[model samples]
Target chain A: MRKLYLAGAGNVSKNLLSLISNLNSDIKIMGIENSRGQLFSEESLSMADINNFMKSPEDYRKSLNISKMDFDIYVDMRTASKNGERERDDYINLMKNGKHIVTANKSGLANFFPEIGKASSEFDKKLYFEATVAGGLPVFSLIRSSFPSFTVDSFTGVVNLTSNFVMKKVNDGMNLEEAKRKAMEEGVAETDMTDDLDGTDSARKAVIIANSLFHKPMRLKDLKYSGIDENNIKKNEMLLAKISMNKEFSVESRVFTLNSEDPFLRLAPMGMACSIGFKERNPVYISEDMDGPLETAGAVLSDILSV
Target chain B: MRKLYLAGAGNVSKNLLSLISNLNSDIKIMGIENSRGQLFSEESLSMADINNFMKSPEDYRKSLNISKMDFDIYVDMRTASKNGERERDDYINLMKNGKHIVTANKSGLANFFPEIGKASSEFDKKLYFEATVAGGLPVFSLIRSSFPSFTVDSFTGVVNLTSNFVMKKVNDGMNLEEAKRKAMEEGVAETDMTDDLDGTDSARKAVIIANSLFHKPMRLKDLKYSGIDENNIKKNEMLLAKISMNKEFSVESRVFTLNSEDPFLRLAPMGMACSIGFKERNPVYISEDMDGPLETAGAVLSDILSV
Candidate 1:
């Protein structure tokens, strides 16, 4: 049985718990690891044990998080920045003690890589945070593990859900307020969507990635930030549709190509795109990929599993 | 210092040695595992060490004919059919006795999975073979080590360079022989391209991947085979270019897409894709974000400095 030390009980953490509760008998995920450090049973935690110790792999996995659940790896999906800091310190200590860590929080890596990395080397424990940048996409593992022989030249993306959502709506001929209204309702734009709209979120993702790709790290403040809102408007529904269908690389590449097709120049307040940023280290351009959920989630899941 | 046993020094084996020899000091890859077994290194060895007393991750992997290298992992890159019964049994005994086995050799997994897996479990040894499938990219660590939570849908890709090369040329107007000749000259097609074009190469790679992903024993013959040939193409350069950057959807709902907009893809002998494979098991995929060999040589030089 593996015990998970879940520091936060947010939507993602709860979802993760739900995913694992019903795993096979051979691999049991005990209750959350808390400051009290008490473990819980499946019934006590209210999570199902789908494996039944003898069920088939597919059935076991469908009912549970994975047919072969390995909760020996701990997960931390906290959204709080302060908790992210605390979690980083805790990871350092745990790594020194040979404990493995899996996290959805990007702030963990953005904040404390050197300390966690040194301890991981000394203790040989795993510290993975693939979910920090991309939502549910296997991005980190692809760069970190699979292609150990390669070095990244640069990273750029079309990040910022609010910016993308707002721009996308604007291109469809909707007014700024109308787009914001729809975005807010659809959960596409946060009530305080300013962070995403202003390119702060994408900048954060960029720096974290720069650090992960190479030993030399970059800071969020060092990036060239931009955003797209309702200013530049002349929608080609055909172009948008083609781009969405992956036929046109124009807008896809436009996310980071500053001074040329800059999304921020076309839109503002409700959208943003921070072009490539480099400060005293390797240059990288981190933006967004795809429309929903973000690529960070899948990557975090993959990184955590490396343990 | 890591000891490696190259059971068969074939195409992949030679390539792996070159890759390993070029590694830095942090990990040492000596020579083939059987250098001592052969008794006379000068006769059978390429990079034979005179004093073989040192055994561990501390030895320098400063030995290679095709390149300079060192490795801390054992890699078997031979085909199963090439390995004799004696070598097969001997390899099993080594694995059973707690020696690590890292190989892309089909027979190793086809014949010795259960026993070796049991032995690895008991001894806490690892058997890593990232090159077994998709020399195009790394998938083993991605699935097995990176994402333990997600259920893999299935993998699909243009795994055979031979077929890809043939199709590419034929699509660009070259005849079968001309395409094959060009491929062989470019080292893109195997010396025996016939097998790959016929789909046996893909079968081996798929089998190795399936065996690992499912954790259930299966053989090469278990899979339903598919192949690509020159006859499938017509003379259409524009369409050829468009198809070269293709995408394949997996049963898992994830899409595998490639971009040939880059110059390297345009110059390559074949236009191909290798994607996530495995059903009801966890899967791994590569990212478009990753940069391959940002000047491959410089990276290796830096690795040497690290060692």
Candidate 2:
């Protein structure tokens, strides 16, 4: 039986625990850690115990004793860290301890992909982070499994769900501020939508895609991106990440307005869409509906199973 | 190094040979067999050798000496057989000889998936046929890799490229016969477009999907379907495969008209699309452009790499 150590007690982690509990698999959640503390058990934790722990995490206000835990995989679903230093250190340490890693956190991978990737290879452990880019879209997995022998020439995508929602509202004639407010009220945008509107979020995902797909050591600082500002926001415009692999990987996150009849523009407001261009083949288009934490957790579970 | 023995010299096989030649991989084409003859080589066959063999197959018109060949994988890209008896026997024999199988032929798997699957499992060999349905769309691979722990409840797709072409032409104010003729002229429809128009091809693919995805032991005879006739063909209507798994699996192939603004309707005329519904998650939408033999061969190569 494989044991899992969850590194967050947020909604995504809660959804993952619920999914695993209902699934008829041998995977068991051995522990869960949050900002306050952690809860660990040799036996698989039950849903009730997990819920209670989430309700009163202060009751278990103690740091995780990593050396004493017996787990096969470490799942990171924590919120994005500014510098990713803490998450990066945790990932490296976990790999050194002979544990596979699965993550939904983009900051760590975006900031320190090569370092984390090297640590995984050095420890002979696998790293899976399908949820970090487009939630539940299977972008990385499709590229890995379906195009194993093909060369990816370029990629273009609208991966930021929050920005997509805000843009759709703005396209429908609402002002930018009003649209952003509506998105937050509808739970479509995070409370702090600064990174999302400033193009940092999309740029980070682009960097992750380049680092993983093209094997380029790219960081967020290496990219020159422009976000959705009120002055630049147009009626039918949306933020897009355009990545090309020539002599070097060129990633640009900018705003573009697709034709009205374009299929990519027809994607749902809460959907993520990407078109992968190949060397000598027709591009493959993938679109997925990103509802909430459940979908992200589903991607996380998919990565877990892949590992 | 992996050695591949192709079972056809058709367009898809030729495309596969060309692709493998250009690919920088360890896979080598060792032999090719068709109704007219067989060609074998101890060393990897070059593109020139393959083209020459195709140009004058009569020069190499001899039965394949299976026992004398050294190959690891057998790729079947032959045209669909009526009963699939020959292909089934070949797959069984190849598995017995300790070789993995990759196929782009649908009839064989549609008619004898259980038998072929059983042979693969019994001999501890792998069977990959991503090109059999929705060529280059990555349907089976996506489900296998991305939804390992999820239960697929149902699927709806417009997978028949020829029928889609005909329907689009009819929607554009062309008669059925004229549309079919144009498709044939453009090489979008096969010389024998009976199965494609009559829904047999779509039903065969539906059966294959059921047998593979749902693990159902189904046959074509078990399915009840109706072909597209002049009276039945309507404007904006296209062939759809609706498959559901309740207490038992239910598969139906019929004509349906999607909304004008529906994203599925916006798919390219030569594209294949599917929406897979899960038990407790948002459905996944996959669409791919099926330009021709090259795309199908790409899927076949992906399967080969997977094996």
Quote the B-chain TM-score, candidate 2: 0.94
Q: Write the per-residue lDDT of candidate 1 for residues A1-307, one digit (tens) a residue.
A: 4445454444455455544543342333544432222333543333433223112222322232211333355667656473246756767766655468787766666556665666777878777766665455455664554434444544444445666677668867798889888889876666877766656665566656656654544444445655553466444311110011112211121233335333333432332222232221122222222323322334544554445
Q: Which regions of candidate 2 deviate over 4 angstroms?
A: A1-3, A22-28, A40-56, A61-70, A121-124, A173-178, A231-233, A246-249, B1-3, B21-30, B40-56, B61-72, B118-124, B175-178, B230-233, B246-249
lDDT on C-alpha atoms for all candidate structures: 0.47, 0.84
Error of 1 at A120 (Å): 7.9
Candidate 1 docking classification: incorrect
User: What clash pairs does model 2 have?
Assistant: none
Q: Candidate 1: where are CA atoms >4 Å away?
A: A1-3, A23-75, A82-102, A108-127, A158-189, A233-254, A257-307, B9-74, B79-90, B107-127, B215-217, B222-226, B232-272, B277-307
Tens-digit per-residue lDDT, A172-220, candidate 2? 8898889888988888888899889888889989988888877888778
Model 2: per-residue lDDT, tens digit, B18-129? 7887778899888887888888888868778888889888898776457447899999898778998877898898889889999999888888888988998999999999
Candidate 2 to truth, TM: 0.90
After aligning candidate 1 to the native by TM-score, how far in Å is the CA of B79 from where it should be?
5.7
If you superpose only chain B onto the true chain B, what TM-score does each candidate give? 0.62, 0.94
